[model samples]
Target: MDKTAIKKFAVEARRSLIESIRLKAATLGITADGIQAKLPISTGDVEYYVDEQGGISGHDIVKRQKLVAELKQRARKNDLATAFNDLIEEVAYTWFNRIIAIRFMEVNDYLPSRVRVLSSTENRNIPDILVNVRDVEEALGGFTASEKAIITRAEDTELPKDRDAEYQMLFIKQANALNKNLPYLFETTNDYAELLFTPSYHDGVIQHLITDISEDDFNVAVGGQVEIIGWLYQYYNTEPKNTVISMPKSHKFRDTEIASATQIFTPDWIVKYMVQNSLGKYWIKHLLAVGSLQNESEIAREFNWQYYMPDAKQPDNVQSKIETMDSSLKELEIKQLKMIDPSMGSGHILIYAFDVLMQIYESEGYSRREASESIIKHNLNGLDIDTRAFQLSYFAVMMKARQYNRRALTKITHMNVYDIPGTDDFKLEDFEILLSQLSENSSRLLRHFLQEFTFGNELGSLILEYSSSLTSLREELDALNHNQLSFELIPLLDKVADILNSVELLGQKYQVVITNPPYMGSSRMESHLLKFAKKNYPNSKADLFAMFIERWNKALVSGGYNAMVTMQSWMFLSSFEKMRVNLLGNYTISNLMHMENNVMGIAFGTAVTIVRDYQLPSFIGTYHQIKTADVSGKIPQHLPIADNRFNRTNQANFAKIPG
Candidate 1:
């Protein structure tokens, strides 16, 4: 499959689907004009509708009630466009779900026996409800007349006097049920279930959309789906407020828009570079610690120290430096070493990290199955604010693991990946009430929990305990500690416990942290997000990506590695001088590959910088500046890192600069 062509096709198909939904909505009297009459057209509401308490006013509530009443009146009169718009969202969601299911089944052989069997009638015992009768009969054998009836009932057909509505309802219900069993492929809740139905989109049109992409040519089955969906999401945001009937004018850009507009599908080579330089470098250090290298030449070859240290005149100094560094990693330690991508869109970084970690595990005599499980359970962690991205990332990781362990999907072990906590659920008052119940000493401790939790291994122990427990913290407290104070503090303790579990997945310190963090300027950020950044990342608040560099630094263990491809403006921009100073003060840059413009198929100038999160005062870092004329639109997959094209720079002097 030509990825570019697939991407274009997917985008167009999505737009067509949305346009159809809009036209359908208009026909049913759910036009934008009707909606605007009840609710004022404000762009601020478009951006802040989900923030509820943050932006919604008393007047907004009255308007919402009026809009609901108007919609209800239309429904009573048999006008269904309001409902149709909702169905459009659901249909789009279901379409993506179906694609993911088909691709996953195609790639993995060892599905549950119940799922693999081809029963024509609705099989309650099987979770593969989306697989229609034709699919099952073709894969297995012929279906009986009774089976054909069941299959036809499940499908949307005009031949039976327009059963599209019934088919849509049945399809959504089955999809939701299927989601319940496949936790790896779906989140805990199907948020779109209520809104989704079998779309009015013709079966032939849907089939044509699927056929447009040649799935075999893609590197990963889910990659094309993610790219297309992400692009469509961006396209949806750019549409005129009047064109999209589902959202109010004030709510023009949804949360997913932030991801859709900013997410760039990272090239494979960039992923490799970031992973090998950071994760690979640390493993080499571990090997050197165990005296695995027999001689100087072997050490050079094994460590690829020559790649980073091209100007080293004396092998003895480099070897001596390696000997002095600490690398007390046991085989178990190496297996469990955590790595994360904070802005893990579609899990490209985490997927690549899985490969590197697998190699490390295999070297220590682990079978591919053992390594696959170990990596998912202990090594890889990812977090994305986008729910769609989270779904794709989670699915991609499981698919990769299934390649190694055929029975991986049989037992749906939850991976460490998660969508960041949303504003609706995470409230400050809840924590405040818990804090008020605690004694002064306990209150003080709560204030510094994020920092203190990393030191005493308390977080790890809590995670293990919580993992095995069936009861919530309130129940645990009620059963074990009957004291009034303990009872009052249960809610706070439960929140803290949940935080610890999240920390376990997104470690306080990891062996490696790699990502292409979302790139959005402060001006583009929502007001609340901008305020949060100012308070949390004072120096790097100008750009979200810069803030992530600071965050990755804090998330790394001493001597841990951090690698990222970000805008190069921070390197020379005067506004980022403090950020640069703070970064150099805390970490040692290993190497930097700077590209001026139109590199990586984007117009923006970018740089790939690899650094270790430890202060090595005497360390010298390598720097390469790729001239604008030397590059075309895309960075070559085989770009050399060890060549003499890079200029060696001393860390001390680089750190001395104010800009």
Candidate 2:
């Protein structure tokens, strides 16, 4: 669309997203006052500014003024990425306020109470739900003073002993259900209109459930359960929106480190080509398993069997699960991959994984169901401390998953694998039993169990028998999976998930570990997060990117691959001595593709390097110099597996001009 149209659309969409978030907050009881100081909704923000001379000003003039002001404020800061994270703090603050509100309502009332008009921030249900209850209570205005006290207690305190928790859950669900479906319930996107008009439905239902139930039935909502409401709101509000806000075009600017002037946003076709090539073997296996599936219907049947009915299939249910298993194996051979961009503005690396995994699935002939599960479960993973990057990653996953299952578009919220089997150290009495043994050796058993998880080990039919042994803990386990487990699961899962998640980083030896990590110099790393990293990763030098490399490489088994589009200066910059030694000592440096300009039209030049984990006899630390390929032209030696040595460098300077 035209520029003005783009601005108009962006402004409207951002406003809608913000407003929807605010209204959702209101439903959970966070009043304007609770969030006003933190996130004041901008009402009269200008769309465009005019010069005093009466002429409309160009975007450049406005953008320059803003940038200069920002630059001055950030003059002492070396890390641009850090400045961006400040915005993340604000966004997260707003999100948590809504979370607290939901918790209060959910904890305070299982059944809807008589609606009392509350001041903003009083932690009550939305005015809509309360308005109807208020009207009903008013109609029966002759209640004794004692009854009013009972109503007041009901509104603010824990439920009486006579309430059924299940009914309360249902009531809360119903209340939330309406809030979630507000757009459809009332034919309007106007935020206040939905809040003003929607309370009557909850009035009768809440009154009936609370007054009738017995006391022994109350239960609390699970942690992260409120996330469901947020997920649903996004689903109900689904629409594809895109817009580009204009900023002043850059004048001559040197990357403070690159020391050279170059335009940014280097085309990534080469890096993409190489990664896809490396992923070829993984893709082929995904293709074979999918080929066995008879059709989409068969695939869908298998999917239903796997997720909704994990036990429904007999031993013969290999039709679809086999395809999934095979793909997982091939992907495993690639080693549970985690690609990061240190200077990750948007999560291009993660999105690229999405494309790569999808291709492998499509190649195998699996339906979208199989493809999506494979991508989400097996292949793609990444991390960026950048909150915007985190959101970008999340949004990208939702969009990609939508391709396979439209319903998934609504269901998947956090892109991080929030819950996986061993992620939160699943304490089966079996594990404690195994670990607690003092006989000739419990180490062997622990090793065996762990080995089974690693190196593609499967306990097979034995898992059924062993899993059955844990029946006594079924209720607890069920609660754990549902995110309702005891506080005990937290520290346990943190440890377990950390170890398991770390495995994805360690198991395969990378032939390449590629990235453009955030280019913060050592002087700028200070905040709590940076301090924690320093304390934890003290000996190992870690910038956002370097730490990513360390963790990823540690996860690599051997002979694995690494490739990255990162800041060019990191190659020879003085501060990176430790990183340089780690690279040269351990990896076979085969290629470095230096971009004269930027990677994201931001002010950093990029270098794409291909490194092999194990050095071949003739190729250690050598620059196999090659000509830059045209983006639209034939893909270059993409995977870098072919046997060719164009140049040898026992030690070469990257900063000095390449002859």
Candidate 3:
């Protein structure tokens, strides 16, 4: 909850983790230049390299080959420098994520072992899991077969032991054990860590993480929130953001750096305001449509919402237009209502929306556990370009679900959160060859669908133009699943099936589409992204945020709410004139709060705007123009004072004013 402290720890953590991981990589004889040393761990026919800590058997030798292949392939993809640094940063951040997750689990007593993995309950410095591994009975978490073998070796008296090496091996075993539960954070054969998890790192980086941050920061009983991970993620990107800015003007943000350059954490208050007005307002409208709730103020009070503005008295025409709202809300079940944050960086917006959805579900007679599962399974969806962001968001949501349901994590088979897939590595030629075997129009649709996924790392959720084709591909793939196929094609189709599910979610309609979309002007866009926006979104091609404003609108139904926190320049800049005209012509704003510069560490002025997907040209919308600069902790305090300065106007009125 302490932003200053979280930021300080995160910025420093990034530097320390990167340096530590790099040092560990160096010890392993892998460097940006090339692999300088190889310990031949021969397994019959294949030549394999031994790791730094050595003494690993056949499985590790095979995994080490995987790691080497990935590194060499990446170096071929870009330069050696880019690939090396990216691999190091990725591994470092992943470990950072794992440490944070373990601490949270330990504090919450959510670990199945009922043991603290990172720090001892009796002593802050000692890892209880490490100590626990010394005794076979202390391994209450239940280790895998390989891990038990390692444990048996650790207990061997004749084996000469280095305590540091012992601890390193034990911690890796614990990480591997946790992998079955948390595959998202730690894949069983984690390519990044397979070759890099060295004895040097445990002696250096792991201790630094445990000792550096305050214990209370990870303890929920002491006022910590799982949302601290979001702050840490934002802070971690500070250096990358600065690096992007320091680049030459013509330099474009490549795939690896795009997320880092554009992710800005939405302040909680702003997120609440956006969600309260969009999804919150949608539920109220549903209640009104079905005559379940009439008085908006009474509903707001019942919900205990600080930012939900009860609608003001409307003119007769505006009131009549409102009366024509979708009464079909009464026909649909609450679970049918879907909401997504397409640019869900660390899922800050979706996290708040989860709480709101929980209240809505419980009000309708669902238990907390049932409602939590339903929210994750049915109501909430998220998408992001950054895999790291996706993982953090996934962890945050899963942790939140675990807060309500004891068995939520294990029971979850799939979540709607997806990092948009890129087509660069896609085996399209093979899929196409399989498709040539008497497929329906699926082959054509599959081609179009895969084509749309191109540049996904750069364009991300903005790749909405092919949603129709993606849906068709889904149907065809579903049909194909029932039929017998070639063994090779079956595996290939299985991969496509997974991607199909995610892309279909990306393209589907939602009742509420909310996000603080990535903000970068057209001038800064990489050539591929710039070209895509120009071709697909010419009207709103001025900035990435503006393009998202247009894109998410397509992701919503007619009566859905499209809400976002974004740079305020879209409201006035000449470059955005066409975009404004398009919005005014198609949608009606319900609420707009224009804030002064540096509102959320953004230098430019910004606004939180909520617009109805339907057109109500005559409807007067609430607009709060707050000039207070950097209202960091003071937003809620300023709202009441801001009310007197607010204006009610039809957004169409903006068209009459000069650009």
Candidate 4:
């Protein structure tokens, strides 16, 4: 699981990718100034491109046409400089992810075609697909005639004869062919991303990606392949993160910048601790409530959840409140339980939650195959503002499912990981003119729902101001059918309906809300984001991570476990006194681990907490504090040696301190 090599490769690959994609775009007549995709005329059947300024002399006009259309569509959204940079960044990451994904699949023998895309089995220097381009149909399981034509046309004498051009065309077709098998990671409409997939096996990113990194790093039997995706993502953004850090205090952090600057990958042990305590504790309590099991210690040993903290002693009067909480879980089904990691970052927490869920399903007598699909479809849910994280999360979860069910990838399982949708340009008058048929009240609600999502991408899953009204609007839309509406309204109605559907999911309550939310202080926040935080979370608005404490608590069901590893400042800072008071007065700290400086490499001091949604003022909560610094950063291993740091504390006593 050592990521030294992966980290080194990822950072180098990012810089090389941006430079390569920029050079490729320049050749396509696309630059920061403008694009001149069309030439003076088409002499007979063949057409000419601006070449360097934007020219194409290829036989196929469709690829050129598609490339121009995608470029124009992206440019319309922002200034030329930002738009070009964004386009380059987007394509670079898409190709990088595809390269890594293909390598992992090829090494694990998970590719549907059983073809090594990046390198050859017979000759490692050449690509396997290139060697057998015309003879891969049988190997591809079920290749279509059109797919064959695409491969053949890539080698047409009229097209460029260069080896790099040839390899790029074949590689793109290979990635596109994989769309049917892995539609989540390999999208069809992202042809713009395809337009810039320039790196090849002969040189550039792919060269080092394969030769520099060991094959064992990608093999599932080696036990760290999937987790490598997370490390790669974190490392790839190293430059952006550094840029953000060096910016002046006056600089406003945009949505995209906010993501890169604040994201810190949680250690594996912390993820396990959060999931085992919340989900594991829930299942154990359920077993006890229903009379299926008695002692949780025995089950904890059997499950090997080393981080599952046993429930601490509670006062006599408060014991019944605990009983009442467990009473509702006596007959709940395994599929009915739900957990959400709101800031889901690469989905490390959700993936561990997936494994714990499988164990729970196994204990309930459900087969591994059945549990795999159910855990993915029902139990595990994730959300992140970054599309890259969402893609990796979806792929990682599906890969995990594939381990249990051989046909999992081919089954079209609807993954729950979502990229927070951003607001797009649209006139309210368009909705009004089209939706004149609907009731005025319903129309108004839909309009406001759209307005609420204006900063959905910037604010992310914390945008909960209009959930109740959005729910009402969803109900209204659900009652109406498209057949009853005019054709123009039908399109608007569909868009509105999809927005409502997404918001409904984002707004749903969960039994466990576990995540390592973004950590940006109010001082560094963008103007709009800081304003929103002050308006929404007036008490916990000093830092992004602390604000999430209130935001996610709202999403948690009463008595549900809301676990997180955040900065320990809120517990003792005078500036956060109001937030601390609100937290202590309202919720019960079921468990807390105060890991001070140097623990887990978070120098600012960190705390892991499992806060029950409702208060048990008299309850004695479990607490673990690490006083001495440990550069090794092995939390679970160091926990035992820090035994003297363990103690029990009643959160209610915190209010007694003098102001």
Candidate 5:
């Protein structure tokens, strides 16, 4: 894909979509105030209500309800934009689904005969069935007529004059089916269901859009989607806020905006460096322990690892260190070796990790199909605060898996990827129940402790177990086990499970942690997020990325590897003295590549630092500085540390210098 062209299209598409939605919203009179109008119910019957009318007049409950009804009626008649959003969302999902299906069919020969039948068909029915929308009514055959009518009305309907309404209905059905069939794609409440309605999507525009982009263009293995979407988000949010009167006030600064403003897609070379040094290094060390590699030099050559090495004067000591290091091969299993990107915006890091992990699995004689499934099921994990990020990441990872095994999605299993908590339906009260079980005698103390508990604790442990159990239960439900009680608990369980998964992410240790953590100063952070960071990570609170550096360390197991590309501020800034001290005290810097500002088309100075989560005395590592300007953005990949263009240094000596 042409990065520049894709980025341009994404920006224009987002602008056009938002404009169309806002115009439709204005026509429908669906303002924030309009949506918040009181219903025809007493205050005692309702939990909350907002008054739009000024002064005491707004307090007239009966009149407010009447006004709300009128607003709703107007919205129903004219508010095509809100419905359009939903249409666009559904269309986007359907488009991606088609892409996945087409790709799967292309490799249908690799699939089981039973599953191949589903993909080989070319009609829309095949795509519909693949996405699980076809026969939706029949699947719920046991329901009452009225209930069935409601379901049918929501999923399948036709409004000849109103294209938008028809599109909305089509999307409702498609989205619901996707949620039912492929839970990974439409996990949780479908947030995109209410954006806008498009009437003419099926009238060639959708085909044109799909034709404009090729399936091969959606490169999940690199940073294609991340770069394109990141640019679109930035352009959308930064556009003039007052250009459209119909734009909801709440839409101006949203979580998506935060994602756009902060996200920077890590370059492919950077991703390679991080994965190679962290995951690659770990594997090589394991090979040495297993007597797979004859010596340190062979290990370095075989793995193409340039980071950790013994001092030229003490090669024997390197052997002794490897012998003394933990020889537990359990951690070295390609299936069990977990790699995570906590700030996984679009999953660029995790996607690249997938590629590296596949190589390791293949090297160990695992077939591509087994390796792909194992990677998705056990090795790869990601979490992003942005819902879009999670969606893209989920799709990207699944798409990558499809490349290896066309039948991968046929297996009823959920990917380990997740979004952060706030986006989900999870509530604080859910945790209250769990905490109460932990300590009924001192609820206050438990609450206080829970508040302070960040990750990698008892709460995290429970969350991991809960998440696994919930996943198993969900699989059972999908397998046609219609236990009423189990079904009833699924929603609550989902909420608690998501909460636990998020918490567990912070608490659990990973074999490799790789990310380009979001870069934003405390000043740019939302007030609540800033306050939380300050409380949780005081030493590294000056910047969000710095805080993640601390969090990443906590998220790693003893001797685990962490690789990150972050702003170079922490290295020399006075405020980061404590962070620097803490990091040096606990971790070994395996390799450092300090690049001059604008080295990789980014305006800020950046450094790729690879660290091991163990503190080892007499550790010798490599460091290099790139000083030359390269407009091509490929120098980092092509240039070797031995190149004179790089100012090389001993990592140990570099760390010894004062901040």
Candidate 6:
């Protein structure tokens, strides 16, 4: 469409969308005089129309302008919901590229192809083709010219003989949608068409789609997507099909099973609260002290959040997730606060850290770019036994930094986390290859051999699994691939073992450590991890998180804090007396947040204990004891729970003794 045609259509579409918005708002008793919406008048209720082919018709542009006007008016009136929706529609429609539109549809089940585009109107226009579902049509609407050509060619052919005509028809419909919509957008459509029209293409695309979706849902965060993108390029992988396209690794699709399990996503509201409470005045104070800012009042005005906030839908949430730990910290003067999550599953903490730093930048006057650079350079770090998790953790950390500066995202690179100094390292690429090979073709003889080598040897099991690829290995079995694999299968397994050991030595220094270490009861502990732990702490008994705590105390500087979330059993269990004694003798218990009676909805009781290396002024002791009257009126002795975050003052007959 010419610019004028596009502009005019944009206007009409915008007006129609606005009318729909108005009508909806009226239902909510929000419209002026509670009248039904009419055309030619602008209200905050603007709608967006994306064509069946997914492009904004000329009508959409006009509606967008009107929507903007309505939003400004609404903002003046302080009608926040109306104003916010108006602004969202305006922004989504204005910058709504086909890629992002496709992405939105890909994730949200509610977004129909003809539904008011991207949080615009809730209602939709009925399409001429009720034949295909509106969702499919919407998904197909964004196809390119090459995609269209592929469809035309497919229509002319006697193909997909193994599949039913209805299946073929759906495929053709999808192809046509691509063709109609994706004029200039889809790259390498010709190559993909060749794959899709062929049986190999059908098989390849299906398998690839299943593989990506499954792997992604398992744990692929934004960084995992980056790695996948890089791998696709490195391996010359193709799109699934000409019509049924796969989301790029950069686009996350939680696996079906995992997605259905529970909402693992940290609630944005909860995240906001955490960021607000944790960072608080520390950010403001640090910003002034560092001279990053003269005061806190300049925060929202100077930072230009649009640059830092990637998803416009949740600016406040994003901001909350990443404000500074302490604004009082200066870029030049702030002491480095190193952290390590030994288990480091999917880098949640690291991602949170990024948000914290961004807020710090906001607290100061630093632009998003300046603040991001400083944080990545100085404040963040992570570790994991699983290489995939390690790569993912790194990816998350870098992505967090990149959110502040896209250019930096490009420069972020991946290196094997196990690569340590003065060691002939094992390459992850080699291990990944072994896994792929195992997936492609593995003999029963090989399986039997691996089971023997891996069973009771968790690391070996992990190697066997990784050797099997994401598709072949069961989810629970995937954890075994971290360290132990059959030595015969990957002759360099021993070398990799050496590298892991060296990494442990080299990575002994860190200031703060936090993690949700995997749980293993004494009976259930995998043989390898159990053996390793026993050898390391010959006389002590503890859980995985406690072992890590001991390691962290050894690693930290005198004043550093080790904050942890761990099971409550560690507090009073007689088995952990030795471990407790060692901890109390070596570290000062600073603060504790205990969730008694399972207050946090955590199935297992847990607490956050802050232990510092410096000694406490009082010998509040090696062990804390308390006495309480039971409901039966019997007196019972009470002791400090595992890490002593609980206050002993409230409980009567309590004692604190030195180790």
Q: Give residue 132's lDDT in candidate 2 (0 to 100).
A: 46
lDDT of each: 0.57, 0.37, 0.75, 0.77, 0.56, 0.39
Ranking by lDDT: 4, 3, 1, 5, 6, 2
lDDT per residue as tens, model 5, 133-177: 333444322344544454456445534444344334444444444
**Would you give me the overall lDDT of model 5?**
0.56
Q: If scored against the real structure, what TM-score would every candidate get?
A: 0.70, 0.42, 0.90, 0.90, 0.70, 0.43
- How many residue pairs collide in each prediction? 8, 41, 0, 8, 17, 55
What are the clashing pairs of model 3? none
lDDT of 1 by residue, 1-659 (tens): 36566555655656665666555443323454444322233353331332223233344444444444535533442345644444455445435545545434432332332343211124232224244434434333344575456556656453443344434433443344445435644432233222222343234224434345554433244543223333333333344322433344344333444655567777666777778777877776676567785433454355333333332332465445635655545342676588888778778778777877877788789999988988988888887765556677887777678767876765546788866533222344546766554556655545445333322211121111112232333243335442654543554565465454454455456888898887766766655566566887888888878887887777777778889899998898877889988888878888788977776667788998888876765566777777655555544545555355776666788756546
Instruction: List, residue by residue over 300-372, the lDDT tens digit for candidate 3.
Output: 7788777887666778987877777676677767899999999898988878898899889988999988898
Per TM-score, the best of the predicted structures is 3
lDDT of 6 by residue, 259-279 (tens): 111111222222222323223
Error of 2 at 201 (Å): 24
Clashing pairs in 1: 42-250, 43-250, 45-250, 45-251, 46-250, 46-251, 46-252, 168-198
RMSD of each: 10.4, 19.4, 3.5, 3.7, 9.2, 22.4
lDDT of 2 by residue, 1-659 (tens): 12233233333433443554444434332333321111232123322222222121243234434433333333334333433233222333223222223323334342123232221125344333332434434223334565456445556663542123222322233333323322112122122222212222123322222222211122222322222222222221222111111212232111221111111222345436435433432233333444543333343233221111011121244335434444444444322544433223334455555666565466557777767765666565553332323343344454456545644533443344211122111324434533342233433433343444321111110111111122222223233452554454354434344334323333333333444444433333324435544654443344444554555555343544566555666666655566666665565554555544432334445566656454332332433333333222233323232344234443334324332
Backbone-clash count (model 6)? 55
Candidate 4 per-residue lDDT, tens place, 114-175, comes to 77888877755778877666665554444456555655665664254454555766666667
Residue 462 C-alpha lDDT in model 6: 16
Task: Show where candidate 3 strays beyond 4 Å.
Answer: 36-57, 134-161, 190-192, 199-203, 430-440, 465-495, 629-638, 641-643
Candidate 3: 10-residue stretch with minimal lDDT: 47-56
